[model samples]
Target: MSSPRRVTLSPTSSAASSAGFGAGSFVVGSLGGGSSFSIRSTLSARACLDCFSPSVSAMGAPPAPRQHQSEPATRQSVQSPPIATTAVFSALVERAQTQYAKSGDRYIGYRVLGDGPIDLLALNNGSNIWIDRDDEPHWAHFDRRLSSFTRLIRFDPSGVGLSDPLGAGELPTVELWTQDALAVLNAVESEHAALLGVSDGGPVAMLLSAMYPERISALVLMNSSARIARDDDYPCGIPQHLLDRFVNTVSDPTGGEDRVDDLALLAPSLAGDPEFQLWWKTAGERSAGPTTAKALDTLATAFDVRGILPLIRVPTLVMYRLDHPFLRPGHAHYLAEHVAGAKLVELPGRDHLAYVGETEPLLDEIEEFLTGTRGGSDTERVLATILFTDIVDSTKRASTAGDRLWREQLDNHDRMAARQLQRFGGRQVKSTGDGLLATFDGPARAIQCGLAMCDGARQLGMDVRVGIHTGEVERRGTDIAGIGVHIASRVQACAEPGEVWVSRTLTDLLAGSAVTFADRGDHTLKGVPGTWQLFKVEG
Candidate 1:
């Protein structure tokens, strides 16, 4: 027997477990790969052929791998995170050989392989704690396929995974989450990289591309949604009702079977890849315990990033499975349409994982998109439901309220507008002075939110006009530009105090909704060419 090493606790037991987990015994069940399937075992292509079993062999062959599976499962030498970022970034640290940064507990995990040049970030999907198996150390198939061409960096976001624990009050919204991604990129000296996001990781990818387009070469989104809320039209996606249920479930101590199953479904591609399956299961179980429900609740109720799709400037491949139970192809379609020149491909298989399931076809598509050999395919169609809103008479209001008081009132206005936006499933762009600019996933939500905001402002003793238009817009910094923003602004200008008005585009997008709009007559505005049919918000 060897001597035990003394351990230190940094609140992220998951990361600390790296030292704690040195055991090398491998185990499997009825579904088994060949006995040669050790984490470090070197399999000849012939050996892997039989090792993966006849079923996986039929699916399609994977790319060449560098390492053998005979070696015991263990973390490769890499840096770990410090105590602070540890709470927010767990997985990266626990398995790291060294810390990325020594500054105030903020750090990220990184692993360099393949050739230099491009950096690839692998964001984490939600992995609940409870799984205890050491996966990568024992999984041969994964080590082989992913070891080529890509320099992969994986990290734990706040409050879960192997990173340190977080304060209950820390808000992990899309913006904050994207901040973590940016921090990782910056820490690793990556000027640019193609982002690959899975499940909830999709929103982070979209936001990163939007905020830092120059830094993202391309994006690969799998089984993700811009909005956490769902509608009757999209059955498989996460409905708002279901999100509420999820919040309740995550708080459970046992990490309910439903939650586990729901997560397992996210990577259905791994169902047959026992090695990967084991790794995923163990990673999730080790991260957040059953009580992490509150953290899950924070994400489920508040995570909405639909507004940033139009801001994307990098090449992208938004791939979604036809039958993904958590997030459907419709969301993927929405993403494809929103991003300026992104591509959407629907292929065979119902799995939500890119590494597992039928990956060859996916790999081929990725290769094509990344190389631009597949060509620039303008797959985006004009969607009629995006609405833009900003506060009116901001110049006068700023003058009246003065710097301090006016700033406070503007803050209040922004808060009210954002709350309404969240309720309506709208996206909040960066704030304009004394106003807010936002886009809704649906026309109904846009109209409803406009009226609500205007009315809410009245109650606060401030009069405001609301304008909304649904059309494709060019992203400018945190705000939107192009005809859509102009039309919405013009609509707001046309509105009388304490009223909401929308352009004809918004009216047409409302056809399917129970809500209706009353004609406000044709209006021509300053600098805006052509007469626009306008309507007042009505029940």
Candidate 2:
């Protein structure tokens, strides 16, 4: 196979500067036969992929073949939060005003968030991006982690999501889909972005990187394949019989229950959870109708990007679960082998979805490859008391006070909270919009801070809830992140107006202190692991 051409830009180059390509960042504009280029500052691709294995579990048994079984009647009616309850979901719903990117007469829907140094375009796995809002817990894991480090842009291609739906009997082709991605990039004023493709979106990312070398800086393919059908050479493809069976199943849209079969294959980890199953079913129905789903399935069966793999010139990372039921490890191996300089990282999980299981490992790999640093708690962690406080019914309060008045009241609330933090020897980490997050060296100090803040807010005629937890937290630059932080936030959510809730850890640490507590009993914190013993603090 011929090599791709390379074009380098000096720091003073107008083209490079205008494109927002940084000084040390490598840019592969085009490739010529047998050409090679060097990246001066970036870590070697091999090093990034091989460095992290301690956190990853050993490979387990391969996943079972997905069975077409009807979900139990009891499981079908499971209850979940309204999609708008999640902040990100609510934001996406309110700001559904997507920018249009013209591809032919049809326009693709796109949204941009964050202003981090790197431009990251997240490609959907043939699902409407909005459907992700249905399961905020699952999707937030990716949105928060990725948006924290990169200028993230998410879009729905033609025939999916909020973008223009396909015409009757019309199916989307690779070329058309690729054009949709390009149009979104143009609309977002991004010269180049690292494409992060999940599941079926991988082939599209591969095609875009090969065809539009200049517009793509790097490629991240997660649990995706070049083709779906098994042939003599590609034994990993789904057997012809299985493909036909799956197609027929999806082609016939019965009820949301029927989608469980597909969900079982796509995300087995979530299939058993009644709440997740319901959300998945609703999301499937909302993302595309039966006809569109069938068309997408048909298009997926015809995908063959083996020829395009070798043509890709930029840095590439291929991540796949060792036990993915549909897309096998063989397919991942084929991609890594064919794509020049591609790094293949086999993660331990049966779930095909990227957001499932330990997502931090995947995020760590991506951050390291793109920015030469693995972000998250991997940096530094310390045991500290975390405090989370929030004003109750702040939205209603804001509306009642109007914008100017609300701003002044919020300012007063913040100042009072800061003063309490200072008096209680707590460090104000950051404001939580309507409240604040503070840290303290001791649980006594944290409890005192929360009590003072609550009393002060009550005096201001604003009710607030405070939650405190003592645990190890990872320091991420100016902010802190970890399961501990999540636990504290969840604890705060459990508190009623004017109440101070804390974890058992906090109560235990404050044994000698004057702080007293009434047991709140063991409660399940949403999106957090395990039942936590909480307490209501009393002076």
Candidate 3:
């Protein structure tokens, strides 16, 4: 079985806590066999019922179905977790779309899974970063494990299963995959989450955990290896030539399903299981042709976690089978040795895939790791003003001019707005697709920055809106966040194109800046609590 699919706001995500997976989804479909009869749609976004009351987004003629023959599932029902507060879900979806659209090819879509404990973005380990709800019923063991936590999300990578495929050059390394994972987390707007990797997913989790230690709470590796290429002394490892050949076979969209070693090495117990093989074949085919093969070629000689090991201070558990082939037990041992305090767990039966084989012990160990200990928190906290700016009718404008001209215009817009922001003594936060987020030491500077950004963008014939608010913000590693940030975004959404809106807090903070506001009166924002009195800049 594969790991869960994902979507998060930040760490690059914070998990969703709700009854089922579709907390933010409205559409549904069915995939797999017995798994077919009983389909599990992306857990309905708990807020879908609330979205148009109001909601949320994706694109494409979704790629073909990730079909697989399946025996009746072992029928295990997972009790869902609690619902996410509006703040959390809003943050999750806002980031989900933000990240999903970044797929190297096609527009990626997502389904919310509010079934588990800690949030999990089952980053599809294939060509596309996407998920098919139809196949959910067939992966019970996967659901049960993920549902055991707070929130779990599943999605296609890019160019596979329901997602459009990109060219070979699109994804050159695991760094791209890791970036895809980060995009999903950013999509969910999560700041931290546990990393649970399986098969080819192993290296990604390790990289994410190492590169951004603060975002990950823990690490779980199943049937994964640090490296597959032979290390002179380790001849049992995958030969480089064999690795290249396998990639060619599996990734070829037109290639026959003469399944290869990577798939073969996955489930020692299930390799011979026809249903399992079909599922693997289907997952790979649906994502992108021979994509996994391309990944293997990259994986064999690409990853270098040596410098990243000791930096991984999070609690970690490595699970591997004694008889697994792709990644030998020795690699697992080597990983534990290098991962500081990581614990090595050798499963009794030799099943290369962590989702298969004897699962209780592996899960038990994971449960202990997550619930038993906490890591050191060097998180810094602060108070500041958060702002969100967006271009109005940006898509239309981009479409009007085509990619080349539109890109040039967009770059100019970014530069001009950034220049004004610096002049106003404001800190540039981040960009929102075609928009921007910024911070200010005072409300006056924030308002001035917002107004200037709108005016500057206007030069490019791009009308934009701005929103600002002041409140307590927690600085987690390098990102700034809080309810204040969410409120600021909503306030921006409320503004008319070209207008700069400010939360009451901002109005109060800017006693010195030459900015005036016309009260729009108190109104309720989607997902935010209570009624807020927003003011529009009259200047």
Candidates' lDDT values, in order? Answer: 0.50, 0.62, 0.54
Name the 10 consecutive residues with the lowest summed lDDT in model 2.
30-39
Question: What is the per-residue lDDT of model 3 for residues 201-292, given as tens digits with 9 covering 90 to 100?
Answer: 66667766655555666777766666555557544355555555444543444534343334333444655566555655555444433444
Instruction: Give per-model TM-scores.
Output: 0.51, 0.53, 0.49
Better structure of 2 and 3 per TM-score: 2
Q: Against the true structure, whose lDDT is highest?
A: 2
- Per-residue lDDT, model 1, residue 213, is 47
lDDT of 2 by residue, 1-539 (tens): 33322222221221111111231222111100000000011112223222212112221011222221121111111112222236664554454455777866797887765545556676663443563543557665556556555556777777777789777656666555766777766666665556666665776677666545555667777777777677788867766665655565555655322222555555667666776666665666666666666666666665676745656666777777666665667787788888876666766567766766545555555665565422121115555678999999999999998999999999999889888887877888898799778887556667778888889999999999999876657778789988778889999999989999998766533332335689989999999888999899988
- How many times do residue backbones clash in model 3? 76
> What's the candidate order when arranged by decreasing lDDT?
2, 3, 1
**Runs off by more than 4 Å, candidate 1:** 1-96, 101-105, 126-134, 137-140, 162-164, 232-238, 254-260, 267-281, 291-294, 297-302, 323-326, 372-539
lDDT of 1 by residue, 1-539 (tens): 11212222121221121111111111000001111111111113232222222322222011222231222222222123111222333353244442342212444333333332233455553431112221333222232223232344545555445455555544344444555566656665565556666565676676555545445556666556666564454343454544555455434444333332332334444445656555554454455554453554445444555544665655566666555544545677777667665556665566555444444444444433333321121223222234544555678878888999888887788788878888867788766565667775445557778888888898777877778876655555555667667778778888888788887655433332345678989999778898888888876
